[model samples]
Target: VFELGDSVNQIDTKNESKNKSAIELLKVPKTVKNLKDIKKRKALANLEINSLAKLKALYLSLAENC
Candidate 1:
C-alpha cells in the first residue's frame, strides 16, 4: 500500500524543477548608453540561446560559423 503523504511530497518535488523559462524585457535603445545591451543580445543570439538556429541540410543547425 502507498502512503498519500509520500505521494504529495513527491508531487511537490516534481514541481520544483531547476529548469524554468524566464523572459527578460529590455528597454528600447534610444541612445548610445544601450550599445552594450545590444551587443549582449547579439552575443546570446549567436550562441543560439535567445534565437533559433539556421537550417542546414533540412535540419536546424546550432554549429557556429567559422
Candidate 2:
C-alpha cells in the first residue's frame, strides 16, 4: 500500500539508490522563482523567498574547482 507517505516507499526496490545511479532534478529553486513571479506586483520590501539558485550555483562552481 504505497499512498505516498514516507521514505520507505520512496526507496527503489533493486537497491540502486545506494550507488546513486539515478538523479532527480531538484524542485526548491524553481519553486522560489515561481513564488516571486506570482507576487511580482507587491513591493520589493515584501519579497521573502529563499533563493536556492545561489546555493546550486555554488555547488556547481565547487564541483568544477575540485
Candidate 3:
C-alpha cells in the first residue's frame, strides 16, 4: 500500500510540473501581445496630441490675423 501511494504521488507531481510548464508557455504570448497593445496605444495617443497641438497653433494664427 505504501509503495502504491508513492507511485501515485510521483505521477501527480509529474503532471503538476507539466501543467505548470504549459501554463507558462501560454502566458508568454499573452504577455507579448499585451505589450504590443500598450505600445500601439501610446503611439496613437502621441499622434492625437500632435494633431491637437497643430490645430491649436492654427487657431492661434487665425485669431492673431483677425
Q: Where is model 3 poorest over a 10-residue stretch in terms of lDDT?
A: 1-10
Instruction: Report the alpha-carbon TM-score of model 2 versus the true structure.
Output: 0.26
lDDT of 1: 0.35
Ten-residue region with minimum lDDT total, candidate 2: 43-52
Specify the poorest-scoring 10-residue window by lDDT in model 1.
Answer: 51-60
lDDT of 3 by residue, 1-66 (tens): 112233434544544554555445445544765777656655655565455455555555766898
Candidate 1 residue runs with Cα over 4 Å from true position: 1-30, 49-66
lDDT of each: 0.35, 0.34, 0.51
Candidate 1 collision pairs: none
Please give, for residues 1-66, the per-residue lDDT of candidate 2 as tens digits.
Answer: 112332332323222332222122222344766667534423221221112233334545766898
Give candidate 2 regions above 4 Å deviation.
1-50
lDDT of 1 by residue, 5-66 (tens): 33433433332321121122244544677767756764654444322212221121222432
Q: For residue 22, what is the lDDT in candidate 1? A: 14
The order of the candidates by TM-score, greatest first, is 3, 1, 2
Model 3's alpha-carbon lDDT is: 0.51
The local lDDT score (0 to 100) that residue 29 gets in candidate 2 is 46
